[model samples]
Target: MVVLKLQSAQFFTAPCEIRSRKRGNGQKFSRIIRCGIAEASGEPAPLGQKTKYNDGPFEKVFMTLFAKKMEKYANSKEQTKKIGWWDFLYDYERFVDASKRVMQGKNRMQQQLVVREVLLSMLPPGAPAQFRKLFPPTKWACEFNASITVPFFQWLVGPSEVVEVEVNGIKQRSGVHIKKCRYLENSGCVGMCVNMCKIPTQDFFTNEFGLPLTMNPNFEDMSCEMIYGQVPPPFEEDPVSKQPCYKDICSMSNPSSSLCPKLLA
Candidate 1:
């Protein structure tokens, strides 16, 4: 008799096939069948058996990729404090802690720009050249949102609304409303979200894909709004840049005065 082991929640996304034999006929069949996104319904976490990440092939692969990329940039220059050793990259929590530590000493603007540079280093040169330009920015944004962004984050944030919104007499081509951000909540760092995620991510999509995006994260609920094809306003005019940090922050620093200089006391 074969001993069956429990699977992890991320197993559904990995490319794996398991064979199970029929007791009576000895016919072999697949234990888990790959699925199409079109067939799934609202807020469903399907095809997941367990929650432990150790057994999750997909999670392992993604974490490894992210870690390697970070390693490349973290060691490239000794000008800043070393974030983490290559050996520590496999663990997400460890990486986050190290990243925050490396970013903590810098001012608000410097923190955002430093993280932005790290993200850009991970992208291939001439990236948007690969994407066909026959479509408008809005169309391209929508397609990318469906195929990549939404799918990539859905598992972490559950179901979210991908919307189109107008602000300041300008219409955003695409927008994604995250009811809650898992990374920010889990990492418990506002600086990490702004510097490592929001600013850098926005710059990456805008520069690489020629699609501008502005991410507005609500600290109270950990919700966020990603508006695509809309460039982030200047620091002087940006509300988020001027917003105060959470009264209680993970980095143990003041956001209004330290993290966000534009936000006056």
Candidate 2:
């Protein structure tokens, strides 16, 4: 088993504010303004052994399941490269690398589609058919979002929070700040970040829930903001959509840009 190198410091993200389109009126999440603790109410599953990072075993199982599902959904050439539960111990971001690898050789568009599809496939049995909807269930959106999505997000990926932001002199929290994004930082592909994670996630939430969302991923620091109740901008108007690969420094970089299907003719 690989010992995880994930440090508590790597988990720290200076929550940044995104210019929100609308000031939220809901105060249901006031207690979680700056910190979100993903408490699972399910019968406590086995977490296996404790890691030096204090990560339990259950999350490892979750990651393995998600990773395997992603690999299965993508049907990439590297089928043998399935991610292991122990990998989370080596580093929480290892799953990101595993995700990118599965989608390797596919275009940004296909990658996006595959991941969105995977999200649905990974849903628990008897999960709502919300993924097939045009908008979130207008009724009880906040309740369901808090009960289901927030905890699942923390389990499936990482701890997320909502920081207080003053909008027009009103201190209201309107979004989730992911201190570390497993998808963006490891993909190392600007187009992948845009198409796979940024665009699809926004569309998925807004369509599945009545609440509109806008996800802004800051490449330099691997931090991201998901503003709820805010409509996302079009492809042309979004800055991350126009970003280029990390000039020769990206893990997936190559001499020819042709490999990046977003630029493909």
Deviation from truth (RMSD, Å), model 1: 9.0
lDDT of 1 by residue, 1-265 (tens): 1112113332343323444656646675546543212222322232221122221334434555554555444423323333323443344454454465556456666655666666556568754566426334665555445334554554343335667677446654467887566556656666567767787777766766666778888876777888776788765566666555554545555644644332332
**C-alpha positional error of residue 215 in candidate 1 after TM-score superposition, expressed in Å:** 0.9
Which residue pairs overlap in candidate 1's backbone? none
Candidate 1: misplaced stretches above 4 Å?
1-55, 71-89, 132-136, 154-159, 167-173, 247-251, 254-265
Query: What's the lDDT for all of these models?
Result: 0.53, 0.53
lDDT of 2 at 89: 41
Give the Cα error of residue 59 in candidate 1, in Å: 2.6
Residue 205, model 2: Cα distance from true site in angstroms: 0.8
Q: In terms of lDDT, which candidate is strongest?
A: 1
| Minimal lDDT window, size 10, model 2 | 42-51
Give per-residue CA lDDT, model 2, range 43-69, as digits (tens): 222222111122334455655666666
